[model samples]
Target: EPEALDPRLRAPDLVDRELSVGLPDAATRRALLERLLADVPRAGDVDLGAVAARTPGFVVADLAAVRREAAVSAALRGAGSDPSEQVRQSDLLDAVGSVRPISLSGGGTLGSGGLTLDDVGDMTEVKAALTEAVLWPLRHPDSFARLGVDAPRGVLLYGPPGGGKTFLLRALAGSGDLNVFAVKGAELLDKYVGESERAVRELFRRAGEAAPALIFLDEVDALAPRRGGSTDAGVADRVVAALLTELDGATPLREVVVVGATNRPELIDPAMLRPGRLERLVFVPPPDAAARADILRAAGRDVPLADDVDLDALASELDGYSAADCAALLREAALTAMRESLDAGEVTAAHLATARRAVRASLDPAQVAELEAYARRRSDG
Candidate 1:
């Protein structure tokens, strides 16, 4: 935060120019690592490119520190005199883990896990829209350029609570091995003046350093609610302005994609939904019987089900269950089976029936209807 800086320094009339040095990109980081390792005794298996790709928020100095740490480890093991103790890929990776980059201190992580869109339960259209809006630009940049079109800047996912908006984002983060900066909107709120906007700026800065990144703002309504309607002394309004600035500001988003999820889309600032901002609004609806079955099967992949535990039949019985509710039902059923017998091997029909009585659907019918109405209004507009 620039809390310590004099406000006069920020005055355009007083300051003529300002220069900002950002964290190193993947290629620059690789080159820096190569230079640092040029004279060091290292194993042939050490791949700097892989290291560079994995270290998203690392700066040039961070790379140097990693090399220094690795060298220290190698020297402690008598690396200079013994070839067997030479710096290896593991040594550098271990060093990378030991050093924390300043850019990453703001909070974000490099994408990980093996989940893909296929793991999600039967949201074919949602998956397709996410693929086109988020993954295509990073995967097929040339195609976009050839067509003389810029990629989508962002996407908004809104639906009833527990309706799988966040689940879809998890699938997206794993789809392309891109960096992901995940943060809940409410986490950015600060009681101190200017702190919230600084946090917002810091988040985008970290995301930009990690290019081809996805900024997942879960519960984004808290961060960018309808402007001029807050009683918090204009803090929410300022946050909305900051978000608008970041969305279509002078500094282009480049390879970064912003995705926001909220249960209350109607509460979001209208300006945020404008073209070139979070323009692609995708409504995640409650799962139908087939989708509920898919969710049950996916959730119960590890849990053994008895011959009588028909997932399709159970799904049909669950009329208002959200994706999360379906998953919870299976979990509760497993717990019920465990309660019935400590040595129980499989969940039975009776266990599921008992579990259903406990884990009722959480979705509010009126809220769902209101969101559906909001979606219709956006679509018609």
Candidate 2:
């Protein structure tokens, strides 16, 4: 962004001193909330400490906004006419949900979408592994300290596209009260020298400021490919070097975990996958019949299905359908029912049969085999 400013104003020597103000920690957040709510009429259920703990990335202004939003909600519910009506804890909680923190509104950050791992259909093993590697460290750090071992640094998730890799990230972020900063690997690249490296540093800096965070690097193969073979004026090589440096930087990632997702993990640099980096490599395999059934059920929870429409039978027939494909099938079926009869009350088996022809499977058999082979190689070695 400095590149966008005038040359004279953006000069490196123009500024005398730089001071960085980050989001408030838990104690500060509680104090700020208490001060803000001191004059407001609050119900006994209102707990500032609980609200402070939940607002991890919220700044001073965001906290103020939460108080304001809670008051507005109470007023809308006829608080002005009724003296007993006050801002309840539910109002504050809802206000927190409504207000988006400035720290998370940036391009580098992502919202958790309020989906937990339990919302995910199946992939029992994948969920269990991630729960232990990513969630466990943040939720139960004391266990690691008692065992005299450091928590895991990062995890690498790889599989065929549409196998719910990104979906898993959303679940992971929402599983706990942690911040999530996500960026596509290609988005980190810049033609200007040192800009990519600066982006990496800035990303990590933000993650550190919002401690107990997860930095998700999507499509990481593009960001950190094999070192020596690139025609792009050594920019890719420099980016890889920057990533490696940050992954094992001297400052250390205190409460931050980096999770990289790629469909082609074989293309990533070896150094990035070494110990203490993204060492926990987990393969998100394509959903089996049972998983597909679960996906269908999850996706069609709101869709009115006729008695004849059997998801289990449909999932069994859809052998190669990815998780996304199964969800899409239900969507198309609903549309088919709408088209066939405007007053149709529910999606029928015939509607699903018609929709199946339109929503073909996106999973590539060759890519799945290659990823499976890569997983085998990793396991063997």
The lDDT for every candidate, in the order shown, is 0.84, 0.88
lDDT of 1 at 377: 90
Query: Candidate 2 clash total?
Result: 0
Candidate 2, run of 10 with poorest lDDT = 1-10
TM-scores of all candidate predictions against the true structure: 0.80, 0.92
Stretches of candidate 2 off by over 4 Å are 1-20, 79-81, 112-118
Q: How close is candidate 1 to the true structure, as a TM-score?
A: 0.80
Q: Model 1 over residues 77-192: C-alpha lDDT tens digits?
A: 88557756778888898887678676656555533355666667777778788889988987788999999998889999888888888877877665545768887888787658
lDDT of 2 by residue, 245-356 (tens): 8889556887888999999999999999998899999999989899999988877878999999888999999988999999889889999988988898999999999999
Query: How many Å off is the CA of 251 in candidate 2?
Result: 2.6
Clashes of 1: 0
Per-prediction RMSD in angstroms?
Answer: 4.5, 2.9
